[model samples]
Target: MILIRLESKGPIFYYSYRVGMGYKIFKFYKFRSMHTDADQMVEQLKHLNQYANDEAQTIKTKPLTRSIIAYSNHDHILVKDDELFEESEYEQFKALEDKKAFVKINNDPRITRVGKFIRNTSIDELPQLFNILIGDMSLVGNRPLPLYEAEKLTTDKTVGRFLAPAGLTGLWQVTERGKAGMSAESRCDLDIEYALKHNFWMDMKILFKTPLAALQHENV
Candidate 1:
């Protein structure tokens, strides 16, 4: 936290909305690693993100896409269409449409000086344990999806993976760790695999192999 404070001007910890099992929305946090203006930089690097080009990741599906927002209170209000919204709400709706899945970048420019060290050392993720303790996640399961990613994952094939718990270390992270050119498709496939086959014994095996990744979330 002190190191982060030295290099960053915003909150020392940054939490974003993540979707867990049953499509539960909760705050997922890490040590602040990106620049305060990182949100503003998304458009600049949008083209570099794998999901930016993935049509499969963007198509509006049920449940998640039907979610509406009360901007004043920032609460989710479920309603079907945008025709019922105010003009300002419609603009925000378009903004949400523009969002793509979160992608992990290599040597991303948005990372601050301290950010790289924390991320590389997995210090940025220590806060995830708190989420686990709070029952927002579990010991071994799927990586929770960010809001943008979860919104599109409501598709039939991808949605079933949410049946698995969200976790700090899971089959996908350990299995795919350090592998070259890991694609979003492969990771999501692993999540589905775990969802279908996971059990106590498999969870134990996954925990044993997590050390292979040095406890990193595949940091790709």
Candidate 2:
């Protein structure tokens, strides 16, 4: 089984997964992709609820709604009930709007010098082979998500993706790998579709096509 440790760096929360017997832990290795102080900036931005736009020039605020309350942690926003937001002294509110559930800004400055190359080449994911060998992940399955992202997928409509194995590559990464500005809903739809239709043969085909997909310039 995979054991996950959730760690936060500013607004970024990621999972470090390990597999071992009681009390023993093994290190997971991967190329570094962001600056060490990245979390510090996240903490600074939590109070403002602001993030850089795709161009990395303008800062945008995440609109909130009654059903979606946003609270600040040291360096991240935690969603809870409206009461929680009030208790935390957060006052900004807006009606729910149609927007991507997940957003990745292009040309993000938080990315490190080498990060751009590795991300563009999809080389940063090479370390996951260790996870595959250790049974923490599959060669073909739904892409593993960060804790913050996973928490939002709790609804019945989006939970099916979790039924599939956490993989190094998946339907979204292949079909939409090169597409820019994909909405979160569209990505979730692909994941759900794959979860409902995945089979050994399908997995084989996805694995076969993965190399070519990775070669695309928009692999990031």
Expressed as tens digits, the lDDT of each residue in 1-220 for candidate 1 is: 8888887799898888999999999999788999888867767876566434344344443433323443354344435553344444544554444344447566678888888777766678889999998999998999898776788777676787899999888998678765656766677789999999999999999999877665453333
Q: What TM value does model 1 have? A: 0.73
Candidate 2 structure quality by residue, lDDT tens digits, 69-116: 333333334366432333222322311111223436555566664566
How far residue 15's Cα lies from its native spot in candidate 1, in Å, is 0.5
Cα-based TM-score, every candidate: 0.73, 0.63
Model 2 scores a C-alpha lDDT of 0.58
Top model number, lDDT: 1
Number of clashing pairs, model 1? Answer: 0
TM-score of 2: 0.63
Predicted structure 2: clash tally = 3
Q: Which ranges of candidate 1 are over 4 A from the true structure?
A: 50-102, 215-220
lDDT scores in order: 0.74, 0.58
